[model samples]
Target: MTNRGRRIGRVGGGLPGIDRLFAALLARIDRGLAAGSIEVTLPGGGQRRLGGRAPGPGAVVDLRSWRALYRLATGGSAGWYEAWAAGEWASPDPVALFELFVANRHSLGDTARARFWSRLGRRLAHLARRNNPQKARENIAYHYDLGNDFYATWLDASMTYSSAMFEPGDTLEMGQAAKLAAILKRTNTQPAERILEIGCGWGSFAMLASGRGRRVHGVTLSAEQKRHVDAMALPGVDVTLTDYRALDGRYDAVVSIEMVEAVGREYWPAYLATIARVLKPGGRAAIQFIAFDPALFEAYARNVDFIQTYVFPGGLLIHEPEFRTIAERHGLRWEERYGFGPDYAETLRQWRERFDAADAEGRLPVDLDDGFRDLWRYYLMYCEGGFRGGGIDVVQVTLVKEG
Candidate 1:
């Protein structure tokens, strides 16, 4: 194994008789700093370490220098803080540093770069058992509960906040609408038929389907989303703040958009089972989800925490194949599969454009600078890259409950 790999494996594992690996790692970093091969010096003072454990004084960093240290500490085979002390890639604006990071995201290592992420996954799994509902609610609140007004400034009239479906040979708007229509078609909507939506965001699909004369029951983990959706509810729709597993009855069709990732791998089986349980035999349900390319699992696992910290908590981009396999395991058959990879790219572009234009208009909120803006920009552009590079895919999967 490579030295980086060995270090990661050792740290990830029990660390063989508790040999004080952190100390050894720290010593190695100290040595590297002394040898000058690792580089350690702070220039300007616009930066400080995130965790309290980072070094101090004379250890200050300029923006450019700090970024280089972050890259080295997080990317290389060793020295988390030592590398930051080097401060080689500093920039004047924090956003520039992030843009550089976003542009070169693929340069990060699989295990070492996302060391904080792996721990989070394990912690989530553990917490899921004890206070699943609270954790679920918090996760939802952290992401979707931000505020409807903020979302409204960019989303479609239907308030569909998930990835839009863009198809080849179609304009962005046409493709997105077509994607939604395609999912509706996949659900085989029948007038007056009962439908269930898991993790419903702002009730766009429910509203659309209800307009088609269907009775839609939408459940969401986010109370804010539920409240917003409920406020817009009409005669044929009901919006509830609830978990997918807690829904009481079966329906003619089920649909979930961009909600599965929060369910986590540990709960995938149960999640699928719940869907199957609520779906009537011969009924059709469509799921549109965020998925990473299967080959990129290692990178995803490592980097997922970055997203959790800055983008979506308890969020994941599962592989379409894995979802398919899980569906098969649950006796659910795939009826049709269409990918919305590029559509997401267009959607992000749209959102970025809207945000930039709005911000330029001096109408944007103050809390949107520095980290928040960086987070949103990274959220959009990296997602675009994920789709464009085929590192990620948004899939609309139509399925039927086996007889």
Candidate 2:
């Protein structure tokens, strides 16, 4: 038996009346399943295949303890996922297991009541984690200050952490470069103009822009990132550990990549206003960000899933209609927009593959504990699933200040 299989023999949690509970759970699963198959191996040696799709394969999940069932029945998707992460159940094919849940939406708590409460909970969660200026700094530090070495394991040499523009057979590095070039082109940046990047990460784009002999100012809250940019010592690039809210002076062009999500919904007006306040007349701006469709935005906000809790504390996604509303409110005219969800999904796949390989070779996890690694894997895969499932998208928008 495999280690996971052996685990089933020693774990506990069966009461005299538990057999009824197990039977009912199995019966409900059997009823709910329509396509795809799930083979459940209960503790102490009884196996049951509950459902199957005619030509597709299924997953084999070995429950090491009765806890997995309780969590699934009571806690919903979060509980079920946490149970897997906790080792209460073992599935050699995790993606297949997730697919089974996807096939049977009820298994992940897709009831109307669940949906209602989920939206309420997500709104509350976002408010609780809202980014006031000080909280914003703390939140940025929490995710970005994990040391340059950690991100270096998964990100490309450019250290660009946002979604990339990709083509078939394109490498992650090439896609990142493409994203940068696309943003610069959309803004119509010129070497004689002044450029301001509101969330310059590690100065990758800033350095690239400065190489064209333009004066580039890249500001961010991440001190470690500032250090990296400073080390580059690019004469025309000014990288600072400063907040965009504190910035002053006019620029010929502006750009921010995937940073608005962290600005919080309540502060979006201020952020957009700041862009308007600092840009010269007729100046152009380009921003790349994660966006959602408003139809599902409310439903999505209600869930406030694992990503919000552990990865980006103050982040909140915005949809396109909402983005246009706020931009128009602040007098920023939207010129063009492009969606890059599939590209982001592909970028994440590459990162996860590289991370797994590096860790397997003992190149990563230098000081990170086992739980941290698990959290990162979950984060990466969860975001990848979100993009692949079409729950979210990344967009690059060209805006003009009535120029």
Candidate 3:
């Protein structure tokens, strides 16, 4: 019967009240913000204040269900994210909230406890979700195969699924086009070279590269993506629905856009070897991916969160140095590294806004159902939060095989 616990209506512990949970959660949050505000409204409509900071430029959160508080209390960030997706909570300023979270990410308590049971629990969750080839395909189909028509409602004209380069004075369409051009330029798609693109989404970059005076073969596991690519029926662009390891023939250049994240850590050696093995002598390869910083890579890699549970299963982001080291071991020298993290944050913002607007207006080409929509919402925003908080970075790396 601690005084603080009793004050929070936690007498004898039937189930922790909102006050006790809120107070505990706020203690963690207090370490992160530089005097910010989060005015919380409990499930039964009672209100509580976490900080003394006022509300004009702050965030308001409504815990619509008891599950929200319970999960967030027990699960930390992963749990909070689940509650958000489950519609257990609402925030007026999600981006700002994300910023605050990220600003203190280094201090936040997402880390699994040092105890054996806690570490074991995390490892088990990760082990269960590791992306083997079959599991990889399942995960790919889970997110990418969600209907081309569904994505058509919000994606830019290019229909590029990866992050776009949002340059100054550029529209979303222009940003996507610029990203494609940047990839092609990095790979030096000139002199009628034969090119291989791993994980081509909707053939946006592949089709564009084909017209760049190069023969492009795009490989993907998503039937929907292959169908969209095939429907274009463009010459010099050969699109196939198959795994990258199954593909044949060497190429003068290779380009992959943010596809490595889905490759899974267990397949990193094979993935790097594939690109290194297939490239002609002196060929250049452009591989873009989202990566965790080296210092935080091990910690981040150890856990599976909301993204792993509902979105990209078997998806893992490696460290930058890990990419360079692995590629170098496979006989590829890293020549350039391009950071597009901010651009990715912006790109996600645009996609989410479009999706939100379309859902509001009932203008979606097809019904996504509420759960699916919320899943996408969490996926996009979570990644955006990762980028904004400097927890991750987006990169297009250039590697060269020695002649």
Which number leads on TM-score?
A: 3
Give the Å shift of residue 37 in candidate 3: 4.9
lDDT of 1 by residue, 87-158 (tens): 343333323223222323343223235245444554465354332666877877887877777677666666
lDDT of 2 at 53: 39
Better of 1 and 2 by lDDT: 2
lDDT leaderboard ranking: 2, 3, 1
Query: Which is the winner by TM-score between candidate 1 and candidate 3?
Result: 3
Q: List residue ranges in candidate 2 displaced over 4 A.
A: 1-66, 69-78, 93-128
- Model 3, 27-48: lDDT tens digits are 5565444445556666666565
Q: Which pairs clash (backbone N, Cα, C closer than 3 Å) in model 1? A: 63-90, 63-91, 64-89, 64-90, 64-91, 65-87, 65-90, 166-343
Which parts of model 1 have CA positions greater than 4 angstroms off? 1-63, 75-112, 115-131, 167-173, 302-304, 366-370
The alpha-carbon deviation from the true structure for residue 145 of candidate 2, after best TM-score superposition, in angstroms, is 0.2
TM-score of each: 0.73, 0.83, 0.88
